[model samples]
Target: MFVSRLLAMCFLCVLAAGGTVAWKQRNVTIDDKHGDEVTGIAPKYLPSHAWSSGPRDGLNAKPNASLAYNGTWHDSTHWVNNDQIIVNFGFTGVSVYVYCIIANTPPGPFFDAFANYHILLDGVFVGEYRHDVEMIPDYFYNVPVYVNTTMQNEFHNLSLVANSTERAVLLLFDYATYTVVEEDPVVASTSTDTAAPTSCSLLPTTDQPTGNSQTQIEVIVQVGAALGILAFFVLVGAVIFHLNKKSRTPVLPGTTLRHISRVPRHLATFYRKIVRSLTSHPGESGGVVGDKSSVAQVRSQNKD
Candidate 1:
């Protein structure tokens, strides 16, 4: 039992360590204008001239102070074809997020306009996002169009493609964010010429997601599970120990000389008197001087 309790405490300590690890990881953002980190290509059916990139405020619109890093974004304007603008990026993390400038209830012929985009993770369709007409605000900058929190901590591919045919559709991408687990820094005795790449762009070919992030709920659940397993083992061990200790004590099957020796002297004497009275013949009320049958029977039983 003591050993089990000690193990349970150790298990709890491990869970605390896991929670600390989860908390240490932080989100890293990658801007859409990072040409080397992200790839933006239009469908072959569409001409290259349709693609454009510039400052978000260049359209005589003010930048939302609380949103959009650097006020720079990528978009395609005045395209009517079904060709989609696909954005591809590679990151090393457990979760991914895509931010874009989406419009809802815009003026002109697009008052009820809506846009759709298909999200693919690692070449497989994960989900789709639809910026419906009923969505709040006229424009949403730096809004998360896609979020995927459940993923393994490794190098992964993410793709976002415009899927709508509406002329009012807006795929104004601003940035992308993902989470990576933090690794403990290794200290070397001497410095080297090579250094680690700090950006997600370098992750695809040169580096891996050594540091990853986790959701609060996932961390809580992991800790809870560890504690549950600890409790179960502790209870089982305690019960088994108790039973084993109890089994070691001998239990007599019937009354024997050893058992009588364990009893008090007064109790043993009283018990012997009762036995003698029961064995005495009914004809003999007084002390037996010579009763052959009774004496022989009692003596034989005592000898046995």
Candidate 2:
């Protein structure tokens, strides 16, 4: 029973180790697609009256109305400096890798003042995107070009601050797109059959191990430890079985067991001495007190 309990404890330890490793090894990512046009996440950030003067420029302005527009929350604007356009992603931040897309106004940059804009994420200044209209020709104003910026960390919300470098240089703002990036460990089973599942779930899997270095090392270590524990348990169980069998076997009589079989050791010795004395002298048993002397004499006369 002791050996069985020890083996069971060892097995539990192995299981706990496996669970710990699995918990530490887990890693996953999730990305969300929330565009202003689709889920209306933008309305919560930008308000209605805080847009630059257009034919009818307001927050949530549609395309084709005016290429010369702006995006984000807050109504604060200024002609001299400090024109902030903020887009809030709320408290629950999304994954990393932010991609923003903006289109220039249809009227072209050569006609209007260019925009020198600074990008910020969660209040930290990132980089700048310059739409210097004077350098660009009128033909290319309608065409959309790519301007990209990357951050070392992900954030909940982002902001684009625009201040006029020149007189009346109002930057036309377009809708921004939000997306998340994620990656997780991909496990492949050795059974490359069409029916096999691609995931490493609890379903039946092949005996062949994974090809990844980390996974292979973990598997080897776990198997080795488990086998070692099992081997130890088997050895202990065999020894215990032999010891128990030897302990239960009966002893032969006439040895030390005979003297000490039932009674106490001292009492057994006294009883043995008494039996030896009584059986050795047979005459003492009949006339020890001489009370039958008369009977003995009568028997002798009859005989004569």
Candidate 3:
């Protein structure tokens, strides 16, 4: 039974590996379009704002707007194709403004609708906008739009397309500015076994004063040393107290008597015999008679 289970597990692992390989081999395709011309795309009478060749032609196309007149124009029949603007530089997002100068006309039909316009990036359709503007006669209109795209590649192609036939002369293209957006890198924080310092202040992040601050390891070592020193002093005090108490206590009377009894028997006997002889023979020989005579003579002299 165990062998069979092991074989089944191995087969499942092989199937999973094959599935992963197949998924990696799959490819995705993106659809794109190009622009070809910018002829009189801007009216001859209006001032030139900004213009670039469409994708249909290479870099050989000329700037369509004439900078001669400071005035700009916008009409229902005029339109400009920006399909040829190359965005070889890398970017994550962009903002474009199409400035229009219109004559006396109240909110006349113009390129204010975003649905009629869209932006492309790297041959991929990215975004579209529809804005509205009601202009008074002889006033200028500034139309701005924004598009966001991914920066998957270094070089990219961008184009603006007008879905409506409405014409509007572009005075200036405020320059295309790009912002680089990147995902913050993932950093997996790991814990270490090393001891970190403990802060004494309410705020843990605040720096400690230079003197007398304790690190974690130092605190532990100091506490251990203090306990050891206290224990040593306590032991020393106990020994001294024991010696003092022993010295103050008197020796037992019974123990002193026992020690005296253990003295040499001959020396004790000899001391007793000498004491007896002195008491028995008080005044005994010729020296005793001579002493008595001298005593009598001294008494007679004192009387006289």
Candidate 4:
């Protein structure tokens, strides 16, 4: 029983240690974003762009193709289409800007610049920006936009369109990207279906109570064994004492002789009485004295 208990305790200790280790190792982290536009982007980095068209040729100028450039001056406005751009990076937030620019001196007929614009994502129209009255050099209108789409599998379309009869120019595209990371789910170290030893349940649920119980049982068993041994020794000692007492009890030499002597005294008295009673009888004879002498001799020999 003691050996079995020792093994069970060791097993339980090992299980507890293993569980602790497993729990410590059970954690998750979001690695990175998962789309296309994040080509040169670091784990959490965002991309930016800015561009412009010349004043004289703005009417025929094309929108800037570079991802980093926004737009500038022009006779006719051009649109920058980010609709095909998808940020593969794992991010939850997106910020976009639409800038309208007008210069002070124009080559000939530069109409007062004014325009309306709209933002789109995944073919769904989200928001719109309208600027009707505008004029002057480096005069620029900025529209700040924000969107929250926590998770995405592919590139999301982002775009801005200009609706203007007068010539309009875009000077900047300020983009700020943000990511919202979700907390990893928690995991248990051990399965609920795992079987534990029965002894684990037998262990004291409380330290003090268990300790007291163990102490009490140990004390009781120790006391009982001690008492049992003591009793056994006491019985053995008593037997030995009796044997010693019996052996040591005084024994007189010639005890039979002493008893015989007392018997002779009693017999002599009896013989004397018999003789006196016989002497008082007139019919007593010498043969009776001879018969009495023979009986006395036989009694004395039997007593010896």
Model 4 lDDT per residue over 1-304, tens place: 5457657777876665454322121111121222224343422211222222232243433323332223332223333442221221222333222233323333235433344555556566777655545343434333343344442533444544444344453322333343323444333345447543322444655544456557767899999999999999999999999999999986543453454456657475445444444444345643353466646655675577
Task: List runs of model 3 lying over 4 Å from the truth.
Answer: 1-116, 136-144, 147-153, 165-172, 179-232, 244-250, 253-262, 265-304
**Quick one: ranking by lDDT, best first?**
1, 2, 4, 3
lDDT against true structure, model 2: 0.43
Candidate 1 lDDT tens digits, 170-225 = 56677788888876543322224554322223122324422322244467799999
Q: How many Å off is the CA of 254 in candidate 2?
A: 73
- Supply candidate 1's per-residue lDDT for 208: 44
Candidate 2 or 3, higher lDDT? 2
| Model 3 residue 19 CA deviation in Å | 47
Any runs in candidate 4 off by more than 4 Å, and if so which? 1-37, 40-108, 136-138, 141-154, 165-304
Clashes, model 1: 5
Alpha-carbon deviation at 269 in model 3, angstroms: 12
Q: Could you tell me how far off, in angstroms, the CA of residue 129 lies in candidate 3 after the best superposition?
A: 2.0
Give the residue spans of candidate 1 off by over 4 A.
Answer: 1-24, 35-48, 56-66, 77-80, 105-113, 134-137, 166-168, 185-304
lDDT by candidate, in order shown: 0.62, 0.43, 0.38, 0.43
For candidate 1, report its TM-score. Answer: 0.46
The true-versus-predicted C-alpha distance at residue 123 of model 1, in Å, is 1.0
| Index of the highest-lDDT prediction | 1
